[model samples]
Target: MYKNLTITSLLGALTIILGAFGAHALKKQLSVEAMQSFETAVRYQMYHVLVLLVINLYDGFSEKMKRTLTLLFTAGILFFSGSIYLINLFGVSAKSIWFITPLGGLLFIMGWSLLFYKFLKISLQK
Candidate 1:
């Protein structure tokens, strides 16, 4: 878990660095829509990165929260950021797939919700 956290932190740092580069360097080349998409991806990636950090802090917790958080964090990265990057790279203009981004956000919310529930359950058990 510690190793995973460290790796995730590194990945998050890379995401931030690349996000900045995309904003400053590629701004002129990318259209407004693409830029917006990129920013959206960056925003969600950073959000989940912080979420992972919080999960890492609770290392001694039960297995349920650990699994849920891991899945959610991975989904957020693969779906949320992945979709945006794909749209930007491929210039897909139909926008029907915009739904995926929200789904990813929903997954993130669900992950946090489960974490909250777990903490509540644990606290109440005491």
Candidate 2:
């Protein structure tokens, strides 16, 4: 639990730092489209970080479920945001790694779908 918390906290800080870096430092270096993509990555990363934090605090989920959700969201952020950062910062060819971004989005969808399924089970119980 503490490990998850620590990871999530670090991710949150990293998200903020990257967002600021892109805005202030990379603004002039990157094209408008690249800058927009960078911002999208930062936003999605922060959004997932927030969800991970909440999942850590919420006690309703079994430990296994929590861990699974955390892994999914974490991987999603890394694949999605990390790829964009690589492309914008290192001039990596997006065509080479295009599949990765969609895979990340799929992870996010799976995580959310699992959560929704759990909620449905709980709702039906009452």
Candidate 3:
């Protein structure tokens, strides 16, 4: 939990820094579409960071399960947000790698499904 907390906190911080950089540094450099895509990446990364923090607060899961949840969330952010960032900032055409974004979305959906399952299982036990 502590490890996830720390990782999430760092990720949160990076989200803020990147947001600021996008607003100020990349504002004039990138096209409007690219800027929007960059913002989408930052938003999703921050959203998952919050999800990680929330998961740390839940104590119903075993350590292994918690780790799995964390890994899934982390991977989701990496694949989803990472691909968006690359495409928007690094000039990687989205058409060339359209499959990656959906894969990341699938990871995010799986993470949420696992969380829901764990919480539901706990509620039934209670």
Candidate 4:
């Protein structure tokens, strides 16, 4: 839990930094579309990190459950947000890694599905 808290905190900080950098440093340099995409990446990353912070702090979840969700979300952030950053900031062609972005989105969906399943299972057990 502490590990996740630390990781989530760092990701949160990075999200803020990246957001500021996007709004200021890259605003004039990037096309409007690129800027929007970058903002999307930042939003997704920050959103998941916020969820992760809650998960880590909430004692309702077991350590194993927290770990699993963290793994899925962290992987999703890396692949989803990281790919967008690569494309917009580094000029990487989207075609070169066509499968990655979708795969990351799939990971994010899977994480949410797992949470839903866990809650349903718990409620049914009651």
Provide the TM-score for each candidate, comma-separated. Answer: 0.80, 0.97, 0.92, 0.97
Candidate 3 collision pairs: none
Model 2 spans with C-alpha error above 4 angstroms: none
Tell me which of candidates 2 and 4 scores higher on lDDT. 4
Candidate 2 clashes: the total is 0
The top-ranked prediction according to lDDT is: 4
Worst ten in a row by lDDT for model 3? 54-63
lDDT of predicted model 2: 0.94
On the 0 to 100 scale, the lDDT of residue 18 in model 1 is: 65
Write one digit per residue (lDDT tens) for candidate 3, span 1-126.
898888889889989998999999999999998899899999999999998988887776787887899999988998999899888778898998898888999999999999999889988999
lDDT of 4 by residue, 1-126 (tens): 999999999999999999999999999999999999999999999999999998889888999999999999999999999999999999999999888888899999999999899989988999
What C-alpha lDDT, on a 0 to 100 scale, does residue 11 get in candidate 4?
96
Root-mean-square deviation of candidate 4: 0.8
Selected candidate, larger lDDT, 1 vs 3? 3
The residue pairs that clash in candidate 1, if any, are none
TM-score of 3: 0.92
lDDT of 1 by residue, 1-126 (tens): 776588578869968896988878879989888788798888878878887877877756755666668778868677778788777766665386878777887887788788788889888999
lDDT of 1 at 87: 77
